[model samples]
Target: MTMELCYNPAAGERGLGDLYLPEHPEHAPVALTIHGGGWSAQDKSSFCGVSQFIASLGWAVFNINYRLTTIAPWPACGDDCLMAAKFLLDGEVPEFAGLDRCKLLICGGSAGGHLALMTGLRLPPNRVAGIISISGIDELTSDFALHSFRYEPFFGGEPTEEKQTEANPLQYLRPDSPPVLLTHWDNDQVVPVESARRFRDRGRALGCRVDYYEYSTEDEGHGIWIPDSKPHRLYPHLETELTRFIESVRPENPPCPTK
Candidate 1:
């Protein structure tokens, strides 16, 4: 079953999400999926199919729409995602009862991917089971000029070095950070693949588990969605990877080593 509910009353419709429940939702794991649109466009609807697919895996999926950068700015979109995750974790909603709060997994693509990392990393240690970032912007400081158009508005115009560092996910890497599954195409024209590589290497050096999949194909670019055929399809493989990662991070499994 699917239900639309508001996560943040203050934000109203922008904070609403579609919750997809599994057949036997009792004690089922929960997954929060965020949509990508350079942090400016798109909404929770963009992840409708993806949420349903995750739900089919016997997981409750909450696909959320956050405040766009055009309307708010840096931290607004990230804050909305964090609030949505907290809503599920708090277990106040009747539909979320019996769901596994300790096994919450967050996933997103492009800008949403960046927000996912930011939201999950900012939470208390071990709160997030895992994070899946697809073509996410890892380091905002490295190539600011190339994406100034997007970053400027996201940071509320002319981002200073401090703001870039503050927004960079790589800066949040800690030994206790939730395990991350990062995937990106080598030749992504939007967000450079180097950012992903840097994040993976830095995270690994900090003893954080970062599983990275780098696609070197020419067909796929910045926005690569799982099971989508338009740009390039990584259907079964992506699905399988997601399943395996979620399984590894379940509450029954030991917490990933921080050191």
Candidate 2:
């Protein structure tokens, strides 16, 4: 199927900018892609090439742009992420036969990964299909408390307690959470290794299907660097795995539905 390309139509260029979609006109599962820029920077189109690549894999891809902190603030960005997902899946979005409600996935890196995990916690277990978090920040609340936190300013100098609870996926555990694939490079310096460990442990404890891939540190640090470029890398494998996940949960032929 071909990928459909469209703007928010409703938001036009006001809500966010340079968002893209695939042209496929069928319910072939959907993946809402978010890009990481420490919450302040980075545009949706920066990851549109990746979204287009995912679209070629027999799935629908929606490149969504949330209100960046540079232009807005913390909760505004987070709320926009949730709002974007709501818009996509509610039949208002014309892409993929109204959001491909049957199969939905959220895949992102770094800050985007944090958003993906947090979004999963807020929504119903079945609202999404699975998560692929590549070097995402899982311990945002803890990081905020630490003096060395890199996203301090972006969070508007420490998000309030309520926002912390909402933004930190580690705060709540859901039993039926969809399968999650987390990738981390142990030696990286930026978003620590503990982030992945905590997420894996909590997810397993909650009875969620969690698979973690740790990359070698021969190269790669601070961000998703060379580790994401291996011959059999997490970044490339995400699309294939996502398709299997979708086929398994296709309602008429759904996988057992997690726990």
| Model 1: residues with Cα > 4 Å off, grouped in runs | 143-145, 226-234, 253-259
Looking at candidate 1, what is the lDDT of residue 148?
74
Residue lDDT tens for model 2, 3-109: 34333444444255332344543545667777877776776755665566666665566667776776666776667667766655554444334335554677777
Q: Candidate 1: worst 10 consecutive residues by lDDT?
A: 250-259
TM-score of 1: 0.91
Question: Please, what is the TM-score per model?
Answer: 0.91, 0.78
User: What Cα-based lDDT does every candidate model obtain?
Assistant: 0.81, 0.63
**Clashing residue pairs, candidate 1?**
none
lDDT of 1 by residue, 6-88 (tens): 99888878989999999988877788998888899988877777687778888889999999987899889988999999988
